[model samples]
Target: MIKKIIFTGGGSSGHVAVNLALIPHLLEQHWSVQYIGSEQGIERKLISGLEDVRYFSISTGKLRRYFDWNNFKDPFKVLKGISQAYRIIRKEKPDIIFSKGGFVSVPVVLAGWLNKVPVIIHESDITPGLANKISSIFATEICTTFPETTQYFRSKHTRYVGAIVRDELKDGEAAKGLTYCGFTRNKPIILIMGGSLGSKKINEMVWMNLEALLVHFQIVHICGKDQVNHSIHMHGYKQFEYINDELADVMAMADMVVSRAGSNSIFEFLTLRKPMLLIPLSKAVSRGDQILNAKSFKAQGFCEFLEEEELESERFVDMILGLYEKRSDYIINMKKMNADHSTSKLIDLIKVYT
Candidate 1:
């Protein structure tokens, strides 16, 4: 009999990336694939592009740590989601469930546990997010991107499988990337990405230093949805809301990267051997997970980092230049890492549990 798997995750693209990386491989292996996500989430949009995958939407609520007016209504939505997920699990009867943790996943995991189906959770951050922390109780096993993350779980068996990067991302052509961006090979390219939704601070900082930055290097800025400035059309500076089909090529041509320290993005850059200067989200905005990821990468010499709290006008250009100067060292350190087998190892782990 052919094995089947149900995957769940949403909220942000980072939550869905691992599932995207795994789905193609599983499909090749003849495993039936399905996804459960929120009705209007980024995951739904991302997953819609893939063929052979059936998607089911559940009523999900934000699993917030702070109090909010919606918190009162969210519990009912979560309960409703659990019921919906339970029915889906009953009908699909998947051999296993894999979740990249987000609010949408909590209900799916609970439903999987209730259905007695094996469930695996992949936590990309150094620490478990709020949703994953709750889902751990129902998960058969938890996989982590950081080895240090294993210690966070008590009863669950946590495995550090490293980062799972998309295979297509590794095959980008620098020439195609340049052509796509209408940029010349005369100057080094700096790709600036501020997550999927964009960053106000990073955008403002780039705008402030645009003249100085353009003097030294060409730039490809993925400035998130509705954040692109049509008024500023300068030579050698390309601004995009997002790059879907040609993201690989764009990344291929980039000499260096300025980005948020999301685990998925940083690992892809590491796989491509792109020296990066990470500006992680501040503790004020997030739970400080990005800060931890950045710190870990800096400690391992894979990248340099600047905390959001410490972002200074004078040091922004200097730090980026300094990172470029020490690019060789970062590449050498990244080369020492053995992340090539992460996907395979994760697949093996899934099979073992199944």
Candidate 2:
């Protein structure tokens, strides 16, 4: 029988990143890989371009923390999603299902469980996301990025596999990166990443303080798809809608990073030993995962955390400068976090479970 596995994750880049790390390894092992996600989700867009992995989209519904009219309609959509996912799993007969916590993965996990497929779910945040919390019961094993997170679980199935950083990111050329951004090595480059959908507040903060920022650092901003302001033109500032194949080179040229506190993104920064200024999403909007992730990184001396509400142009500019001044100190601490970068351990665990 051919070895086969199904991967499910979506909603945000964090949820989908671990799956991306595993896809190449699975292909190398000669396993047939399939992905299940919502039709319009980020995962479908990111994973569909890969030729080896078969992509399958099903009905999906968002799980909300606040009351919305969609709440009533979403449960029915979830049921429909579960049905569609169940049919796909039954037909594909994947040997295993790997889920990276997201709202879309919940139905997929449940469907895999119903089909008697073994499931493994990886949680990137300090706490389990709402989707992962719901899907945990169906998972045969639960992997976590934060060791502290295992305490909340029953302990038997919990494993600390660390973060999975992509292999392609390790070998970026500074010249290629600089060339791609039309930047020179005369000034230090500061890369700002605001997640998949983009952070409006971060964009505003950067633009508001653009002149101050340009004086000290060359800027390469990943502003999300269609989020760029074509109106702004500056010699030292480069804004891109999004990046894929060129992300490594762009990041390779960066002297420092300013980013959101999504666990996957932060961990990648740590792996690269890049000095980072993190602005986590407010508790009002998210479950405070980013806030806690940022706090942990700060406590470990890996990065500095600035609250979104406290983001003033002057203060934000100061924070970036402060991070730049202490860049070496941050890189030293990040070097000590070197153990988390390896995918071999995660790949081994998946094989044992497979």
Candidate 3:
């Protein structure tokens, strides 16, 4: 029996949310959980002051494939991070390490491999991130959100367990959540999320078309903490800096969602059976993955892809209005693609490795 577990990964909400999803299961099993992440990452802010979970800091940064001045500094930083992770692993002495694939997970995963601790990586995207790609060589098992991800990894240890979504998202009643988000009974709501830090392009496009959005549907815009300066006086628009623990409700109540094509965010929309309009980050060096994710959803008839460049104010307003007009069709497609209880399947697989 595993008495101690180390959860590593967290630079964005995508990586952090995986750990958050698995926590309840670990707690019920009476496992002591320790989290190792970068001090500079958003994980530090999200997991701060949480009880029962010990948090340790590591010096880490993203490994960009391109030439940058920061690349020169990475080798030393990675060395320091590895040493810090080694010390933490020695002290904590976890039976297994669970990594959710981010820059922070690299040090812990490497250290765990060297120390003979079993490392399991959960890749939450169709295309595995840089850390997961490298860590798969030493990982005992690789858990993926989509089956398509296995082709990217040479490890025969891969298994498709779907995305590990929070229990609240998995089992929570969508209707009640809609009510909590200030929606009236039977009114179709539209949810908007610009990703963890907020997408300036998405935010600007939504802001430009806010007047049109408020006409037919209730809007719950998760404006993200960085971009919450807009006035919230629309007839049916409610804005939040962050949703805290009520994301399930917001998702459940929404008839359709407008969001970025981040894997985690897309999975949430898929699991909730909410039709989506995905605007992937155009500036990313690896831009094709999200576009592919959006394409898959679109091909499956669950969501529509609206490229960032095509998201002019008039175009966005017309597209949303068109979706609202075809609401029933969108709902049917979303329900068809819903895969809600994926976390339990993921935990069951992890138990085998444990």
In order of listing, the candidates' clash counts read 0, 0, 1
Which numbered prediction scores highest in lDDT against the true structure? 1
* Residue pairs with clashing backbones, model 3: 177-249
Regions more than 4 Å wrong, model 3: 171-187, 283-285, 337-341
TM-score against truth, every candidate: 0.98, 0.98, 0.92
Tell me the tens digit of each residue's lDDT in model 3 across 47-73.
774688889999996787688999998
Cα RMSD for candidates in order: 1.1, 1.2, 2.3
Tens digit per residue, CA lDDT, model 2, 12-80: 888899999989988998999999999998898899779999999999999987899999999999999
lDDT for each residue of candidate 1 in 1-354, tens digit (9 for 90 to 100):
899999999998899989999999999999999999999999999999998999999999998988899999999999999999999999999999999999999999999999999999999999889999999998899999988999998755778889999888999999999999999989889999999889989988898888888988999999998999889988889999988889999999999999999999999999999999999999998999999999999998999899888887779999988888888999999899875599999999888866
Locate the minimum summed-lDDT window of 10 residues in model 3. Answer: 281-290
Alpha carbon lDDT at 45, candidate 1: 92
- Superposed by TM-score, candidate 1 places the C-alpha of residue 283 at a distance from the truth, in angstroms, of 0.3
Q: Write down the lDDT of every candidate, Cα atoms only.
A: 0.93, 0.90, 0.81
Provide the global lDDT of candidate 2 against the true structure: 0.90
